[model samples]
Target: MIYFFKLIRWKNLLLIILAQLLIKYALLEPLKVDYGLDTALTPLGFILLVIATISIAAAGYIINDIEDVEADTINKPDSVIIGKQISEKSATNLFIILNIIGVVSGFLISRAVDKSAFFVLFIITSGLLYLYSTYLKRITLIGNIVIAGLVSLSILLVGIFDLIPVISDSNKSSQLFFLSLIKDYAIFAFMINLLRELVKDIEDTDGDYKMNIQSMPILLGRSRATKLVFILSLIPLMIIVFYLSNNLYKQPMAIGYVLILIVAPMIYSTIKLFNATHKKDYKHISTVLKLIMLTGVLSLLLFQFILLK
Candidate 1:
């Protein structure tokens, strides 16, 4: 059981579940009192939606590990599980099984919501995750963007299911409000994950290079890769600053919290990325980026504060 969870990067899986729950409960539920959760889908419907999300994510991890088996032997030999504890055949089977479940559940739920077209979303996500492992993982730049966009989709999925069903001609205000917030978080996730993906490329440069994967690090060199990540970090940093400057300024405490907890750490990440050379250095950079991502999600708690007033 422990090996299974660890294999799927279970902590990260749980974090996804928690993040979705927080959005559904902490954000959407409160808004419901003012508007509506806006879904004709029952509790069972939302449960299936969460299932679809987790199933696709789990399948992604399985395939990612399958592709990483060779690279992991070189980069982190101790972590490789494909042919050791779990056979390649077994992992592939699980990948197929989970994807089927995710897609089927999505198909049913899409039909429930009068959007039969949504089944394509599940299929596309599954295919993209597979392609990301098989082909894109070897390509430069494009691979990182694909994975980051999928990460954003995890957050956006909730909004899509919850809001899309009820978007009539009448309540444009509610529909637009939810869509805007979802887009904001999607962009935020994209920036943070894109940075993390590049940092991982730098960290895993040794294995990736041996695999002849044309990652930014292997193509551009370590210092240049770090510089690229540093440069890209500015997009999100500026976004948060503008976010703070415009939205949170009225609440000094909120502004201070955003600046200190979120903004400062990103600035610090950029500075640290410059001097990082060893794998361990890039490992720290990866961890710092993960922290920033978590803080960005947790910042949603502040919305409660604003709503209370």
Candidate 2:
């Protein structure tokens, strides 16, 4: 059981659950009455959505692990689970089972909202993750972008189901306004996850090279790739600054929260990235970036106070 949880990356799955919960309760629900908005999913339906999303995500992790078993053996042999704790056949079975649950649950929820078309999103996401693991991960940068985009989509999925389905003419603008808010956070998640993926690419260069994987670090060389990633890391800082100046400048509390929790840590990660040369250094930077992503999502809670004010 313990190994199964680790194989599915329960921690990351929990983060997905947390972000979706915040989107529903802390962000979207608060705006429903004031903006004359209606949500398509009830609380129970929303729980099903969370299950669908995380089930597919866990399946992704399992399949990725199965395909990367050789690379994992070279990279982190001690942490490898597919062959050590669970048989490859068992892992594959789990992958198929989870995907079935995810897509079926997605179908049920979409039909419940009378937007059966939304079911395609789950199928596409599942297929993309499978492609990413089997083939795309071998291509430089493509896999990183694909994974990052999916991370962003997880955040946007809530808005699509909850808000878009209920957009009447009277509430179209308000619906879009709140949907745009979710989109902004999704973009933030994209930028952070993209960088983190590249950092992991750098960290696992040795194993990737051994496996003939054409990752960014293997293609450009770790030093050059790290330099590129360091430059890219500046983007979120710039975006946050622009966001603050345009929107949050008047809200001192919001500004303080962004600076202290998100901005400061991002700067620290950037500086660390600049000097990061060893695998351990990249690992540390990756951990910092994960925290930044968490803080960025938690900022959604602040919207409750901001909206009320």
Candidate 3:
């Protein structure tokens, strides 16, 4: 059971669940958004949506591990599980089972919301995850962008399933407004995930190189790749600062929270990236980036206070 959790990357899976829950309860509900008030999915339906999402994500992790066993053996022998703990055959079975559940559940949710077309999102996500594990991940920047896009999609799925299906002519304007807000956060997730992916590529250059994977670090060399990642990190920091100044300046508590928790840590991570030479340094930077992502997600809780004032 422990090995199974590790294989599926349970920490990441939990983050996915938390992000969805926050979007549903913290952001949408408190705002009194009317889009899904009448025809929206029930609580049970929402749980199914979360399950479908994490199932696909878990399958992705499993397939990724299966494909990267050789690389993992070289990169972090201590963390390798495919061959040591769980047989490769069992891992593959789990992957297949998860993908089935994810797609089927997504189909059910789309029907529940009376937007069957939304089912394609799950299909595309599953396909991309499979391709990412097999081929795209070895290609320069494509893998990073694909994975980041999927992360953004997970965030946006809340808006689509909750708001779009219930949108009427009367509520269209307000519905879109909240959706645009969600999109902003999704873009933030994409940028942060992209930077983190690059950092991981640089950190895992040894294993990737041995596997003949043409990642950014292997192609451009670690020094140049690290510099590129550092430069890219500034994009999110600048965006967040601008958002705080323009949108949250009137709220001192929100501004302070954004600065101390999100912006400040991002700045620190960027600086750390500039000086990161050793794998451990890059690993530390990655951990910092993950924390920034968490803090950014948690910032949704601040919206209730903002809306009240």
Candidate 4:
């Protein structure tokens, strides 16, 4: 059971759940936003959505682990679970079960919301995850971008499911406004995840090279890949700074939160990446980036107060 949880990356799944809840309850509900006003999901419905999302994500993790067994044995032998603690057959079964549950729940939710077409999002996401594990992940840069897009999609899914169906002519502008804000956050998630994925690629270069995987670090030398990741890391920093200056300049509390929790840590991560040489160093930077992502998600809470003011 413990190995199963580790294999599924329960921490990441929990983060997904938290980010979705914050967007739904803390950010949208507090604004009395028109986007979800008409077709607002009840608490039960929202729970179902979260369950479906996490299940799909879990299945993705399982399949990724199954496919990466050789890579994992080299990268982190002690942590490998697919062949050590669980058989490949059992892991594959879990993957199929989770995908079934996710798709079925998504279908039911689409019907409940009267937007049956929305079910395709889940189907597409599932297929992409499979392809990513089996093939896309070996293509230089493409795999990182694909995975990051999926991460961003998870954030944007809240807006799509909650806002799109409720939108009418009367609330179209307001709906788009709120959705645009969600899109910004989703973009943020994408950029941050992209950098982190590259960092992980660098960290696991030895294993990836041994397996003939063509990750960024393998295609471009380690030094070049590290330079690229460091440069890319600056993007989110500039974006947040611009956002703070333009919108949150007068909101001391909000600015302080962004600076301390978001901006400062990002700066630190960027600096650390500049000198990162060992696997442990890249691993630490990855952990820092994950924390930054969590802080970015939690920053949605400040909007409750900001909006009320």
Best by lDDT: 2
lDDT of the structure predicted as candidate 3: 0.92
Per-residue error (Å), model 1, residue 233: 1.2
RMSD values for the candidates in order, in angstroms, are 1.5, 0.7, 1.3, 1.4
Worst 10 residues of 4 by lDDT: 32-41
Please identify model 1 stretches exceeding 4 Å from their true place: 35-37
Provide TM-scores for the models: 0.95, 0.99, 0.98, 0.97
lDDT of 4 by residue, 109-193 (tens): 8887888999999999999999999999999989899899999999998898888888988888878888898999999999889
**Lowest lDDT 10-residue stretch of candidate 2:** 29-38
Worst 10 residues of 3 by lDDT: 32-41
- How many clashes show up per model? 0, 0, 0, 0
Candidate 2 regions with alpha-carbon error over 4 angstroms: none
Better of 2 and 3 by TM-score: 2
What is candidate 3's TM-score against the reference?
0.98
Write the candidate numbers in order of decreasing lDDT.
Answer: 2, 3, 4, 1
Model 1 worst lDDT window (10 residues): 32-41
